[model samples]
Target: MVGAVHSLGGQEIPLRDPADFLSLVQRGPSYLVREWLFLAYAVFAVGEGVGLYYLTRPARSIALWALVAFSAGILIGIVQDAAVVAFVRQFPSDYAAADAMTRRALEPLARTVVAIIDVQQAVANVLLGVGGALYSVAILRTGVASRWFGLLGVPAAVASVFFGVVTAAAPRLSELQAVAEYAFGLVVLWDLGAAIVMLGFRDDARQDGHANSPRHRGDRPAA
Candidate 1:
């Protein structure tokens, strides 16, 4: 939903100029806010992680912290997103008209800002990889909810680990970095699928409990 809304705001800006990036933000303040939804995404991830922790706690205790670690990475990554917006906000309104010395000064600062974001992303990816790997192993071991989930998780973890290395090693490769983005997307999708499975099957557990309860004793034939 957020991505759809952002696309409506404008097309992509070339990175050759910081001024262009600032102007893009200025042109669509709402879009900038939409992009800030990265924080919201992290918040939801934390909620999901905590719930998963409790759900699998009985048999898969270690997976819980790994899920938490993934959430932690996201929380820290939000700051990097904020820094990006801050840079855009700080850029002068008259950047194009600025003297060469001023433009030169700002360019390096902009590059530095982008580099900071890249490095932070690499760290977050690493944390996510660790979390996904641990959680996948736990799922397979416990078989508490769904084996399909475990199967999905194993590959998801691999993708996370693969992309984490890519991001750390090749931060400047925009095209190659897209694979990392897709890998991250895979992890996100797995979480969504797992949530659905959890919700759908919760009623079965309740039914099983009710069937065995003393309340059902009178309904059954005497043994």
Candidate 2:
């Protein structure tokens, strides 16, 4: 693979032409290889979602379910990016001088892509927002092992849902995607914070000991 690429300095970098890089899937052998690579990536993504479900399952049902919904969104996105986009990008688009038949053939693909984009925005963003919000609520209700789970999770989640709706309608707004990325980033940080908080919790035996300690025993009020 290293030798295949036309890297600079140390090695050769692959695809000297920008067009080759852009239409990589339309090419031959490389396209087949990328398909396998993407399949592997999709598998890894599934594993990650399952791991998340396992960890959050112990929380309230709201959190467990929210995470599941969020994972669905992520999977949809993976399929679109890894499979659908690759397949769709292979179609030729420069139809200005093409005959009527060629132009007619291209229009269907264009419409399909726009439709996919509309669905893609909702599944990839909206569900994430709803799930993140519920997970945060679960954390707050359960008292995360650490202090407050930050003040931004709810806000970010709300933004994520809002962006999802707007993006689905507009579909072509590139800036909206960037905004959703930022909102989703915060949601990710919230999850990390939760994991860290849980990691700091003491073992069951230690918690039992603390409960039975003389200080706590003496401090106990009437039943």
RMSD of each: 4.9, 9.8
lDDT tens string, model 1, 29-108? 55456546665665566666666665567655587677677777776667766665564455544455577788778776
| Winner by TM-score | 1
Q: Cα RMSD for candidate 2? A: 9.8
Residue-wise C-alpha lDDT for candidate 2, range 1-223, written one tens digit per residue: 3213522111111233334333432343444454455446444545444544444455758767877877877677576555444543444335344577876675565556646755775667687677667666665665543325635558867877877776676545654655654565565566566555444543554788988887878875557
TM-score of each: 0.73, 0.54
lDDT value, candidate 1, whole model? 0.64
